[model samples]
Target: MNHASLDDFLKHGTATLAKGPVALIFVEDAVELDSTLRHHLQCGFKAVVALMPPAFELADDLEDTVHRVAFDCSHPQAVFDAVNRVIEAAPGVWLYYGYNAEYLFFPFCETRSIGEMLAFHTEERRDAMLTYVIDLYADDLENCPSAVSLERAHLDRAGYYALARPDPGNHNHPKERQLDFFGGLRWRFEEHIPAPSRRIDRIALFRAKPGLRLRSDHTFSDEEYNTYACPWHHNLTAAICSFRTAKALKANPGSTFDIDTFRWRKSVPFEWHSRQLLDLGLMEPGQWF
Candidate 1:
């Protein structure tokens, strides 16, 4: 059911908050909304909460399973507010957040459920999961003008790189166990992308807790949660195959004429599996059987 605002939805819509491993999909646009919801559901999330504008209609196929909430996603704090409130309401629950065109893939995600992954994560004494926002674009944008087609999706196999993340308080020292990742469409079209928003590393999966806050840069207020890995070993890192950046670049008037093709020599067709992402070093799986 739809609520008037984020607050309204958090208060009324989430009657079954105790259900763990909820996927909050904040839809900035309606494109691929159905597929995004379907992917999360198939991954065995107990609930898939979709936050979208009031008028945007969810596909009929999703009405039975997906929870629809009415909220504007344009505001900077819109996603953060909803997530923080949900975390407050349901502490200790596994939570994940992403956009419409993004799909989450953990190690062996083809066979394992998100709940299983979180269970393993909890055993490792971790509260969050690091996710790489791997850009996926239509190989042939001519046929699919939206710049997103799963059948013809392509990604840069080798453009991925990382740099030391600066500490928020002091630029002199780098943040421990944290690195700013860059690549994919955002890196390829750096001229069009603002410098501040280039990093694609996000703590997309986490356990909800009191006083926890999701920052604008996709980091968390609690420093430990923002860490890339545990003390002894790297944690399982998920990949969000997304067409959001590609779609935005193609849609934007400023960049449309300049970008004749998103593909370069390094571009390769996405295998649409966790193994491909793992092989490319786009994501990591630590001590996960």
Candidate 2:
């Protein structure tokens, strides 16, 4: 469809999406939704929702722009109906990721447009989607040897950037020691998210290789035998570049980084992006709606 048609289609869905680009969060129990909502808003996510509303008006207040859908499998047909209800109202793209996320600390490229993301290839999908979730612990903090591989930055040409919040057990009960973040399983996302019309590329701060290594402790290591970001960790940047390179090359070439990957000894750090938050005064607390 043409640009005008796309714009008209999106206008119809504004009710559900509100001022999105949004994040579709799925939570179970004991997690307070209020803190989660505040964090998402602070992180720049447009809206947050519960996958299974806890049978309370507080969670499913749709007029407020957040949402909750019950997981009553007894009513199987209703699931499809609700999916349609949300889809019909949500415009642009839906990022089915969590507010407490790991990828946020890394480089990210937001999908430029929904139509472009739909067309990415399978090999490109992982590179474009998943995150190499890290489990950081208190004692391990002092031992933080850099996680690097291939010397080349992993690229994802079909993914969007989102945060992965850690649970108490994920880090440490007090949550003061370390954290456990998730990279949503690949197939889990086939439906919840939408495709983009054009790709966007955001480079990653982590250096990576096409392969992984397992440490003596049975943990994952990179080509260099150290902790590393999986190819997918690069997020939208890899997704976009891979897609464009594939179109030009005329076929999907597995994960497009290298037959012979290149690297820079002096790598850039991901924390640099935080300056934007500092500059805009977004780092401070403000009014919440």
Candidate 3:
């Protein structure tokens, strides 16, 4: 990393206890964000939340540092503008993030330069695994859009959770702040949030497919989504398991079928995929380390 980058990280981070904010972008419901904020805070995330088309639930968060900015849902640009507004307004008070975003920091390592990095510590091995993840998404220039984006980011691999594409996309590049050599990278660059780096059992893009224009009803966890004020939409992804069961029934209609009884790849080892994680063992904090 360059001096400027290190300076920015220290200036923007430090007290926040990590690097980068986890951003949760939702149109109406804020329940999941509420759960996630609590989860990360427990896991040591000093998070900042940004929401649009405001809801009262945001006000209920236990963290005093969480912030909210409201915008019209019809205009997605306004929502993003709200994010920029907060980050721009508070240059570096704390690591700023929206609803579900959290920070990832490399506090374990003290190597200051690339030369020092070559003497690989166990931490370096972990960073390499995360880099390989980026590479997996990048290798196929076509057919693999996520990989392509990571390749373009070219984040400093000598760190934990190197920055990837920002949430939504790289649409907002406020013209005023332009570092000549850095402009392109800054365009849609995301601040890297720390993760296990190598221990990510699963990489899920929940409800992220474009064409699956599911209604509020067809959308996963709608019942919980509707009663979010009362908090009925538990962390349980109520849709996925049922969907899997339904698919099985469609393929084999004659078998004695009960959604409750149906299970697929159930006995697999340490499964993190939705289908398998339904009964996967719980992970205590810092288990991967």
Candidate 4:
């Protein structure tokens, strides 16, 4: 069902937010919106919320399945606003958020439902799951100017690294169990990408509670929610295979002309399986066997 505005959705669409494991997909543009929604839906999310501009159209199947909200995605802090508002409305729900052309993949996701993974996480007392935004782009930008193509998607097999996330309030000491992850196209083409947006690590899958806020850096207001793992052991992590960065770099006139191709020797075809990400060490299964 389509709502005129975000407030309208919150007021009238409360039923959609009643359940846990809901996906909040913010549509930045029309590209691959349907595929992104379908992916999450197939992952067995109880509900999928599509926040997009009113001008965009949705497939008939999706129109009936997803809760559509007319939102200004271009506005600054739009993601933060929409997410936090939903968090306030749906406390105790598992919430996941991402942009168009982004796909979430957890360990054993091919056979296991996202709900199953989250269940295991909850059993371990983890309230959030760390996800790396792995950059995906078409092998050739000349034909596919937007740098997106599901059939020909390519991602860097290496170059992923993490640094200690400093705590400014505590004399710049590294935040325990937290690291600022960086890599993919953002790291390869740093000059065109802003420093703040470079980190690919995001606590994308989280349980909402009162006063929970999604920070601009993709971390959370609650410090524990931002941690990569429990102090006891490593926790399950996911990967968001995304073409958003590639699309942006190629779309932006400033960087478009400068980038001839996103492919390099390290670039490899994305197999679209959780095992590939696992083998590459992009994500971990933790103790979930």
lDDT of 3 by residue, 9-77 (tens): 335533432323333333333323454445334433334343444443543544365434443435534
Off by over 4 Å in 4: none
For candidate 2, the lDDT comes to 0.30
Per-residue error (Å), model 2, residue 24? 0.9
CA displacement after TM-score superposition, residue 29 of candidate 1 (Å): 1.4
- RMSD, every candidate, angstroms: 1.4, 20.3, 20.0, 0.7
Error of 3 at 259 (Å): 14
Per-residue accuracy of model 1 over 1-289 as CA lDDT, tens digit each? 5567777767786565787898999999888889999999999999888888877887788888888888788987878877888889888888999999999999999998999889999999999989999999988778877788988999999888899888759955898898889998898899999998898998999998998988878889999999999888878889999999999998999998787788889999999898998888888889997
How do all the candidates rank in terms of TM-score, highest first?
A: 4, 1, 2, 3
| Highest-TM-score candidate | 4
Least lDDT summed over 10 consecutive residues: which range in candidate 3? 127-136
How far off is residue 37 in model 3, in Å?
A: 2.3
TM-score of each candidate structure, all chains considered together: 0.96, 0.30, 0.28, 0.99
TM-score winner between candidates 1 and 4: 4
Query: How do these models rank on lDDT, best leading?
Result: 4, 1, 2, 3
The CA lDDT of each predicted structure is: 0.88, 0.30, 0.26, 0.94
Please say which candidate is ahead in lDDT: 1 or 3: 1
Q: Which candidate, 1 or 4, would have the higher lDDT against the true structure?
A: 4
Candidate 3 lDDT score relative to the true structure: 0.26
